[model samples]
Target: MRASRFFALRERGTDARTEALGGLATFLTMSYIVFVNPAILSSAGLPFDAVAVATALAAGGFTIIMGLTTNLPFALASGLGINAVVAFDIILGRKVSPDVGMACIVLEGLLAVVLVLAGMREAVVRAVPTSLKLAIGVGIGLFIALVGLRDGGIVVNDPSTGIALGDLSTGPALIALAGILVALGCAAANVRGAILIGIATSTVLGLVFGVLDGPSAVARWPTSGDFSTIGDGLAPGALRDALTWALVPIIFSLFMTDFFDTVGTAYAVTSAGGLLDERGEIPKVRNLLLVDSAAAAGGGAMGVSSVTTYVESGAGVAEGARTGLASVVTGLLFALTIFFVPLIAVVGQGVTVGKDTTLHPAIAPALVMVGYLMIQLVREIEWDRPEDAVPAFLTIAGIPLTFSISAGIGLGVFGYVVTMIARGRVREIHPIMWMLVPMFVAFFASNWLSAHVF
Candidate 1:
């Protein structure tokens, strides 16, 4: 049989099975975040159970939106970094209320919706260079790896002790680290369900060795309470606070980070899943942005913080999820999990370390790998002619170090302008790109002044 004909037959033979497997895999991979983030935020004083229900509902709604509108094979959920930012940085670090923090998230969602409706997202995206997108992707990867390492107990903070080895020699931490490593290795080797398999195995081993203990360790899966109380903790006054000066930085941060993260994630996952065409555009960008915006808004109403696209959706795509059907399936599963919150909670609490102590050891290695990969990619760009290389490198490396994606993107845009001017190729660049420079500078300077002056 001809190759196309043979593949067609094969696709027909396994389409239903593949899709079912894809949906299940997607659920397993994301359920942890769906369950854990709310718990974490709630423990920090937000309504724990309310956040849980809201997260699931918002995620399901948005995933369905993405599937129906975009026809792209991807899933949506609460973002990992954004949640940490909301819970730790905005809420605790700045001493802001969770209500106010969520308000900012709502504002961002509104802004995103406006951008999508105005057709501005596509324009803004086109204005950004492809190299910059890649840089953002690599930077996020490094940042994520760093977070994992810190979480897994592989890295420790010691000022007086001065960088001593962490307790990798200990049992619970060691086992978790080992399990993560094995799963990551398997993922690299193209193993299916790598993350789910890793977490499950680690949890079981933790239970077996007494590493897993107590009720707070495992996450409650979902329950009737999870579904029935979606909008339990909203504070209208908090929304008003978000409308004030306190929300300015939060809004900017949310928009910049979510925009780049979503873009980079789509690119990486689509490529991995063989979904992108020759030009690297995921079809229906407009629809994707709309769903993302809607999801964030939904999350806000449901009493959670921000909801954005999941990079882990790549896992689903890798498993051969090809259409909205996959996302719909994923959404339904999330809705169904409402009844199993107790099981999720037990699992989350039982097999994990104390919230203060739980760590992921692979973070350092992952960061190192991402950094190396980024450097390698940057070097391949022709920098020997200073005009070609300096800006790109600055853009690539500056994000994580500065802890601001907008700053990094701004630097890249600024470099592009200077390079164009020096090379006498100024006309090729757009006026709007130059506009970003002053905006970024103003934002950064204001933030600096706020920190120092206030």
Candidate 2:
């Protein structure tokens, strides 16, 4: 009764046993993040153990908060595309320190919180056309798939062609290919946690082929050094460095992704769970947004990345989880993963085939699999209208080809405005969209502005 009172389980037409099963289902569907997040973030030069710990802490803590505050079955974790931006785009591409890159995430999260408080988050979302928003997800999916291919050694840099097919005969490549097949097979069979299962299978193949080293320890309590990334974004000078003119658009880009992602995930998951209000909107949306916004900042402060609601919560909903009790269960599972750091380390470690070529056979397939999942949004875009199609195409191609999510979004925005003006539909463009034009122009010329104007 106390549990029912706290989570309003009976009102939601759910019981404790159903909530527990739903929580387990959701956790199984998403537990791959525990291995994948650290694998991705560690490439940015963050400590592997630290990121692993931070990732679990953020996911567990935020998901529990989401359950308690909003009484929804939504779960939170370090977002996939957002982490890629923080790791590759901000830190490696821009050549900024990890602290500065993470500080950008913090700023973006805080800005989102401000926008939500001011009731302007929806305004910003409406400013961008639906086609462009959908295209952003598709573009990022290609970008992620590209990264996965490169990491798995199925694709490699070429002297003449820029990139070419890699040596599939290699152990890592073979394992990756096999892993992808296994994942796809499982998915086709409606397997739960297919991606996680693929990673495990690939890791085993890697071990058998001697391409991966086994874990030194099975489990242990993490030490202080394992959490050194905590609060790194707030260290002196990090936030200052992140606030530069050149980085502002990058932060805005992150905010846009996080903002739209939460809205979309919340709507989809709640709708599936029959948890929508009479108006067909998410119940307690403000509370949900607040928790998601705070999680983004919390993830950055913990040195992971932006944390957001996962669409995979639908898996729990499918299992009869209609209340936040399921979320609390998911959070507890994530918390339990902290002790299995050694097993995580084994799968996350990269295998070097050459002086410059490192392969992640165990983890690469999951990236490719996730990309496949995200890319499914492509069907929602209308291709017949050139105005929408052209901009969407530019965005879809720009992200993976140019290696910049923001650049792709800017291209799409610029093209959308230009095409609308060409069609004499200028008045249809939102004032916020108009504001974005100059900002994107500035973003495109940021290096020049930083050099001459600033």
lDDT of 2: 0.86
lDDT of 2 at 191: 89
Worst 10 residues of 2 by lDDT: 121-130
**Alpha-carbon deviation at 38 in model 2, angstroms:** 1.7
Q: Write the per-residue lDDT of candidate 1 for residues 161-205, one digit (tens) a residue.
A: 643456787765576577677666766787765665666666666
Q: Which candidate has the top score in lDDT?
A: 2
lDDT of each: 0.64, 0.86
The positional error of residue 337 in candidate 2, measured at the CA in angstroms, is 0.6
Model 2 steric clash pairs: none
Question: Runs in model 2 with CA error above 4 Å?
Answer: 271-280, 382-390, 422-424
